[model samples]
Target: MSDIIAHTGSAFRLTLRRAGRSLLARIGCDCPLCGARVAGARLCAGCESDIAGSMADPAVPRCPRCALRLRHGHCAACLAGAPPFSRCVAAFDYEPPADILVHMLKSGLRLSMAPVLAGMMARACARQGLVLPAGAVLVPVPAGRASLRRRGMNPAAEIARALAGELDIPLARAVLARRRETPRQATLDRRARRRAAQGLYVCREPLAGRHAVLVDDVMTTGSTVRAAAQALIAGGAQDVTVLVAA
Candidate 1:
């Protein structure tokens, strides 16, 4: 009884806070980063410039497969063999301000930032010529039921929802799902991670030759995205494109 009451109280407080923030957003608001009044913008000019600078790597080529910054034309690993995905794009490097912002969304449940970040990512993809194919759908990598129960929402789904709007694509939330609980990827090494992620995802709907853009907050080893692409392909998706904010 006490636990239930505490949960309800916490939820109420979160709701109240979100409502207050929404009200401020409607009238006027400070930038999410520096607290300077930006009126209609999510970020102040200076912060926006900083965020752009963090991802400004044009001279260095990136791997077409995983979007990793490359030295020679193609990354050695990619040259050896490509993953299941056709292409990948990342908006920012997993560093400093980007890291902080992702942490805020994933851990703190600051969903208000999703649209801003997704817009930036979509713009970045355009600048790099990573356009989505016509009729492609934005499919967020699904979170397990256990994870959803704990976080109350899926950060990847939130980002994908916003990104679909920005890209003018349809969002497919129930196309894929986790088949069963799996160990955390962070608790494993590269080889172990790949093995652990294998066959973890199941396609819940028939894609039937539809193009899929897998959305996630971050792409580290690319293992998660690869597994997801496999599931999508098995479900009759024509191909998978990887999209991530960091």
Candidate 2:
């Protein structure tokens, strides 16, 4: 009788612990950006609003094709020649608190930020009056094998997964792949980056007659996406659109 009672007590304690954990999870945690308490969300309301406000300001002139901030007219690069992608949509400028969130996800490995960032990207697209063509698919830029090995996951793929859920678009996770591991673009100059990124990506599957929305975490010189878009076009994608969280 004592043994049976002991076993019952252990089972009861285990159930209580699980219930406690579930309750804590529901109660919420601190926001990643401001450290404020948030309920069932990654960021607090104030932080989200501030980040949204910092997104592509209407007053500032920006390139329609690449979203680069401009002083008077379109950027020289966009004007010089047409890029492979039709247009680029960015959730926010790569600065300050927005950049902090991106670094947290990309380098700090805070994977929970993926869905939050995706939600923002969706909102940005709406604000820009952007529309995905019928039958458009979301394709994440493939990370190099070295990056994958170091991070144990691809940040772009995570964002794409969440964005796919938010936009109700099909995700073609494996449709694009890197041709080889190259030096990080952040270390290269503009000309070097462009040259290095050329032919860096290859499409693994045919995308005939389909529009592709290429997703990534950030866009600096735009070389990476340009290369990926070229590969998609070569693989028969009718049109390519670039979407980035930064």
Candidate 3:
């Protein structure tokens, strides 16, 4: 009798939570990209347009090899020694709007916004003519135990699944796993971050000859993605690309 009552109570709370999200989504219509509260849309149309415009703009210089915004076609560091990833691209600046969106999506359990963000990414890919040949895989950045536990779900994987659906590619979560629950990247310095994440990820599946695209909620110093890319390369992938949530 007690178990039944507890289960019912938990179910009620879950339903209420969903209802609250629906109400908030309708009242404020959370912007999927900026987490802004606006009227009449899952993503306030203006914020969507702004982020889309940033992606479409030609003014943003990116490294051809890593896809990071460079002063020119390439950054000297990349030119001298490129990372493991074949390409890397971000949809927007790491600053406001995009930052808020990434934070909310990861910490607020806003899985509802994944599709909207995926659509934005699909459009960006189309505009850039990123060719994901069939069999190309979308592998979201693996999260440490702590991050996954805190969110109750892997936000990066959720975004990757939505992106894969939009792009008609395969989502491959099994290829990579976070082996070490290390210090948070946001808290560590660039060097410390790299050291902390060193060999922290393991490739669990065959990636040989496969075109793999790594997905993540955000990119800061690029060490985490780079480390994961190294693991992917070691896994036998032909090349690795990074698709950072704008």
Candidate 4:
């Protein structure tokens, strides 16, 4: 009986969310990044183009594992030892107008920007020719308690929800859980960030033989996603791929 109630509640919430999105599409709104008026979209065409142009240049050298930009050779960290994830795909570099989208979603609490970011992420996957194997599932990195209390929503989970809809994939919303809250990664050095993220996440679901597409809003040092991927692998996922809004 409890399971039936939970499933019904989830269905009700999903229906309400879809209705809200449809209403927004009909009314139209201004672009969140810029002040430009947009019709039936959250981002203006100019802003979208700027974001598309900000994607990592295919010609530039980068780490095959983490997608970190490189001057000539692959990233030293990835070279010394590859990250747990198979590959990382970012919609755009974390800069300028693109950064604004993340800020709006996270700090500004503009939940409507999620689908816009997800659409771009889906396009980024296409640009990279990324193909998910059968039984691939989207799993969002869970937010810390402090962030959830402040923002009232996890930006990564919101993006993952929209991404799942865009890609027509299943979303394992509660598969990964945060073990404990630590200092913000932005406040720590690279090595410290990795240490802080160690064993920070745990997988609650069995993912044996399934491909996991990890989703996040932005990845700086990649410590968070790396930790999450390790947890997924430990949970028996075949492999993990990272997709971020940047």
TM-score of each: 0.81, 0.84, 0.78, 0.86
lDDT of 2 by residue, 135-206 (tens): 999999999887899899999999998888678788999999888889877789999999999999999999
Per-residue alpha-carbon lDDT of candidate 4 for residues 92-149, written as tens digits (9 for 90 to 100): 8888857888898898888888988998898889988999998999999999998889
Backbone clash numbers for all candidates listed: 0, 0, 1, 0
Please give the lDDT score at residue 57 for candidate 3.
64
The sequence of per-residue lDDT tens digits that candidate 1 reaches over residues 1-246 is 999999999789767866754665466657777888875426776886777664565665677678887867767656766888888888877887657778888888888878767867887788778867798998999987777887899989999988876787889999988887877667788888778789989899899999999999988877789889999999999999989988
Q: Extract clashing residue pairs from model 4.
A: none
The local distance difference test score of model 2 is: 0.86
lDDT of each: 0.81, 0.86, 0.75, 0.87
TM-score top scorer: 4
Give candidate 3's whole-model lDDT: 0.75
The residue ranges of model 1 lying beyond 4 angstroms of the native Cα positions read: 1-27, 39-41, 71-77
- Candidate 4 at residue 52, lDDT? 72
